[model samples]
Target: METVDLVVPVKSLTAAKSRLRGAADHGVGDPKAHARLALALVLDTVTAALAARRVRRLLVITSDPTVSLEVAAVGVPVAPDTPGGGLNPALERGAHLLRQNDPCAAVGALQADLPALRPAELDAAIERAAAIFAAGPAPRAYCADAAGEGTTLLLCAPGSALQPCFGTDSAAHHERSGAYPLQGDWPGLRRDVDTGEDLRRAADLGVGPRTREVLAPCPHP
Candidate 1:
């Protein structure tokens, strides 16, 4: 099987994972607690991506400089989005990096919020996509979100002209853009943690050690 490259996109810690933004809106607790939770999710997601065997190398795409704490022990490389734009631009930069290093490597565009993802499950889906690519012309592959409303995982040819679809209704948007959906057992791939509902779903699936450690015993209202 061909090795793959995974790119994880993370927004600023100060503003990431906003659904839990005001977990302590009033005097419930310290405001920094929310930021702490956001950072934990990012770290766990990174750890899972690094754990995948097919992912020879991992690249973290972000504008935030605080990634050092999360990735320091993972040994993965970090590349700041020089374009310094939004999500798409950061992912585009990551795509460019992958194409330059491993021209034929399939790039996995990952959202940095899936704390319940497991390595083996992700590798299975990746191997499946590689099989599909090797069988014929390269096509984009998408992994649906837990709610089944959005997209959580995007795999495509490195440097493919069609960028990843990551916004609202992203599953359909990516499908419309010629990205095929790949089925896998990874709860993480289907969990985007965008709202209170997503968090509850992740808990039901049993989140990673890091996330289970950071978040409350269960997703709170």
Candidate 2:
């Protein structure tokens, strides 16, 4: 079995998904505490990736100095963004870094906020992607977000040409563009912390030790 390298794209803490502005309920926290909480969760993402047996290496892509230092503290390599402001370009930079280092390695793109994602689930997804790549000649393929709109996990064929389109409605768009759908692995991987509602949904699934520390009880059914 070929080893997989997982790269997580972490948005800057000060400029993350702030459109859904709201207060955090993590008990003792500041008004901007959610941002810090989000960072904490992202750190855990690397931990989960490192725990997966199928992964040969785990890297985090970000521009935030604090995040970069913090992630490195846990022994995960990080590639800081040089010229990307948004998610798509940020991921592109990560891809560039990976290609520069290991041009032939199979790469997986996972969001940095899925604190509930387990190591087993990640192994399964990577295994499935490796199987698909070996099975056919599909040049471009990836998995969509939880609601199936956002792009949570994307896998590239080893040494094959690939493109990323992980914006809103990414699920349908990826399908229309011929990417296969992955199901029944880890629901937490798809559930990104974008809004209050999203937080509630993640809380319902019961997250891991990393997420449990930063998040307060979410208010939703």
List, residue by residue over 110-194, the lDDT tens digit for candidate 1: 8888888888877888888777766754567888886676877788854455377778888888888888778777776678787
Model 1 score (lDDT): 0.74
The weakest ten consecutive residues by lDDT in model 2 span: 20-29
> For each candidate, what is the lDDT?
0.74, 0.72
Among these predictions, the greatest TM-score belongs to: 1
Clashing pairs in 1: 146-190
Off by over 4 Å in 2: 19-23, 26-31, 83-85, 216-221
Best by lDDT: 1
TM-score of each: 0.88, 0.87
Q: List where candidate 1 sits over 4 angstroms from the true fold.
A: 22-29, 82-84, 158-162, 216-221
Write out the backbone clash pairs for model 2.
none
